[model samples]
Target chain A: MQLEVKPKGHTVFVYIKGEIDLQETERLRQEVDRYIDHHGMDHLVFDLTQVNFIDSSGVGGIIGRYRKMKDIGGKMSIVGAKPTVEKVLIFSGIQKIIPLYQTEKDRIKAEK
Target chain B: MNVNEKDFRVKNQIRLTIQSRAENVAFVRACTAAFASQMDYTLEEIDEIRLAVSEAVSNSIIHGYKNDPYSQVELYITLWENGGIEIVVEDHGCGIADLKQAMEPTFSTEPGRMGLGFAFMQSFMDQVEVKSRVGQGTTVILKRKVRQPVESKN
Candidate 1:
């Protein structure tokens, strides 16, 4: 999987491309944490439209990141998860804590 | 696990032995999906099998092998003529002592893990049978039935 970070105002958007399964979740957590630490960016958006698949390990990675985000007194949101991927996320019960949006625009709209 | 005589009639079968590494999880997922696709299963069913297969392989790598990367995970897949499938993922590593607690949702021996592996296997598939011997290994058997293909949702 490939991970890229974009900073817009106070929020950081993470564009993930590829499958987020057991093999790649550790790298995901480490890289995203690095971005958050190095830039000190708070509000985070995970752009998952390009993610092909995700399993429990990926869910755990997201939940682990949420805990870090909470500890830092910040917010995190998920954007553009396909139907299958969305179902896995829901089954893991992470959607109850992290708001999921169809797009970054939708998240911005929800904020207002 | 109840024995069904019909389930013994395997239309197709496959066996694989992979290294106990994280990367092999995706390999197992892809292989299972490809093998199951030969039948009349839908795309969603294929994805479900893929997810369940991934979870089982991940558990072996993380909990069973303890991330040793040198161990082995064997997979036995049987496709029934009636559009049903049985997948067995096995690992010879540290085993679970408390099977009941291990299957509980949100219960994990390792921290930072969701502990939803068994749950996902049980949820996505029709049946999930777990057999483990502490200090010997663990085996996960997943079965699903997709006899009739529904209207394609394209």
Candidate 2:
């Protein structure tokens, strides 16, 4: 997985691409947490348009990150998950708590 | 031998082994998705395959091995002629003490588990047969027919 950070005003957008499985869970968790701590960004957006697969472990990692961000008064939003990935997220009840946007533009708008 | 019936055909097979971790779920999903795509299965059929495979692998990991990497899960897949496919999932770990309870839809050894894995496989596939014994491990056999749908009467 690749993490690209784009700072647009006060919000920080994190773009994640590739399969987020158990193998990549630790790196992802650590990277996001480090970024949150380092930058002190209030708004976080995730781009999952290129992510093809995610399992329960991956979901757990994301949920963990969301919780950390939430605890620090930061907001996180996800954009562009394919149907398969979306199903797992929805089944795991992650979507109910996190707002999912259909496109990057919409996610940016929500961050505002 | 029937000379006309001797027309040649070829078969394909796929196999995978994964550790008993929640992480393996992605492998299962990717593999099942690839299989479905190769056979041009419909979206509904693809979802069914994903769910069934998930249950099969999850059962092997959770019940058979109990998250012990020392225990290994083996998966064998065969694509046969006449649009038939067979999947054999085996685990060498702690075996189920009661086959009946294990197959029950609501019976689960793991807390928060729905125990719908076997039931889901039965509902989605053409055939599902499980053979298991205490101290002998478990094997789940699943078969599905592609390119054809079971007809239902109105």
Candidate 3:
């Protein structure tokens, strides 16, 4: 998976591409953690618009990160997950905890 | 959890063997996705097959083999003339002690896991069957029936 991190307004937006599975979760976790730590961001945003596939491992990784953000009094949000990836995330029951936005503007509106 | 062979007829088949490794998960996903594309499946249907296969293979590598590179994982895919498909992912690793509990959504024996492998398989596919012997190995069978003349939800 490819990730590009953009730090904006106390939030680190992670744009991920390709697939998120067992092989990519570890690296994604490490990299996102690094960006969160280095940028000292107070919020995390995941841009899954380009991500096509994810499995349980990816869900686990996302939850782990969510916990990390919660521990630090920070927040995380996700935007633009396609129907397929959204199915797995919703089936895992993560939407109950983290906020999911179908578009970038939708998240902005909700946060506002 | 027996997949009665009498339920469907096979028109095409493919079998693959790969060492248990994290990277092979994508390889297996791509191969199965490509194979499913041979049928007149919708993009969403094709994506479901990809996700289910990914979850099964990931379980084999992560849970069964425990990331052991020396172990091998086997996959058997059969295509039905009606655009239906069945896949069996088998692994020779530590097997689950309780199949029912393992299939439970969000129940994971592994630390820091959501344990949604079987959940995803069961949710996206028409049928999911698992057979495992503790300390022996595990096999995951996934099947999806084609919805003929079904158009995309566009």
Candidate 4:
């Protein structure tokens, strides 16, 4: 998996590509956590457009990050989830907790 | 009494064994997804199968083998003549003590785990049956029927 981080004002946009499964969840968790800790961003946005596959472990990693942000009075949102990835998120009930947006522009606009 | 073996036909079958490791999880999924592609499954179906297979293999690597690199995980895929697929993921590691409790959602023995592996398998596939014996091994069987393309009217 590849992760790209871009800081836009108070939010950190994390663009993830490739498959997110048990193999990549630990690295993803560590990277996101480290970035959040260092940047002190108030909002975390995940761009999953390029992500093709995700399993329960991947969902767990996302939930863990969401919890981490929430504990710090911050928010996290997910955008551009493929249909297959969206189904797993919905089935795992992550969609209800984290807002799902179609694009980064929509996510930023919603937060405004 | 002799049974006619010719009466039963096997369409396609494959067996794979890999060391119990996190990296091999994706490999298992990719192999199964590629095999299922021959059935003309939609992208959605393929994703579901991949997810289910990943969960099963992850369970073996994490819970079953407990990160033991020496242990091996076996995967079997069989395509039936009726356009159905059967997948079996087996591991000769620590098995579940209570199958009932293990199948329940949100019942994880490890921290930071959702314990939804079986749930995803059940939700995605038509049938999911688990057989295990503590100190022996565990085998997860998943079956799904491929949707036939709609016939066009001439």
Highest-lDDT candidate: 1
Candidate 2 per-residue lDDT, tens place, A1-112, comes to: 7767787877777788877754576688888889888888777878889886665456667877788889999878889988877876676667777898889888768756
Q: What lDDT score goes with residue A82 in model 1?
A: 94
Return the top candidate by TM-score: 1
CA displacement after TM-score superposition, residue B97 of candidate 1 (Å):
0.3
User: What is candidate 1's local distance difference test score?
Assistant: 0.91
lDDT of each: 0.91, 0.73, 0.88, 0.88
Worst 10 residues of 4 chain B by lDDT: B1-10
Worst 10 residues of 2 chain B by lDDT: B1-10
Model 4 has an lDDT value of 0.88
Candidate closer to the true structure by DockQ (higher is better), 2 or 3: 3
In the range B1-154, model 1's lDDT, one tens digit per residue, is: 3446854677889999999999888888889998898777889989999999999999999999999999999999998765688999999999999999999999998999999999999999999999999999999999998757333222
Candidate 3, which segments miss by more than 4 Å at Cα?
B1-8, B149-154
Model 1 residue A63 distance off true place after TM-score fit, in angstroms:
1.0
Under the 3 Å rule for N, CA and C atoms, how many clashes does model 4 have? 0
Q: TM-score for all predictions?
A: 0.94, 0.65, 0.92, 0.93
Worst 10 residues of 1 chain A by lDDT: A35-44
Q: Which segments of model 4 are wrong by more than 4 Å?
A: B1-8, B149-154
Model 3 Cα lDDT, one tens digit per residue, B119-143:
8899889999999999999999999
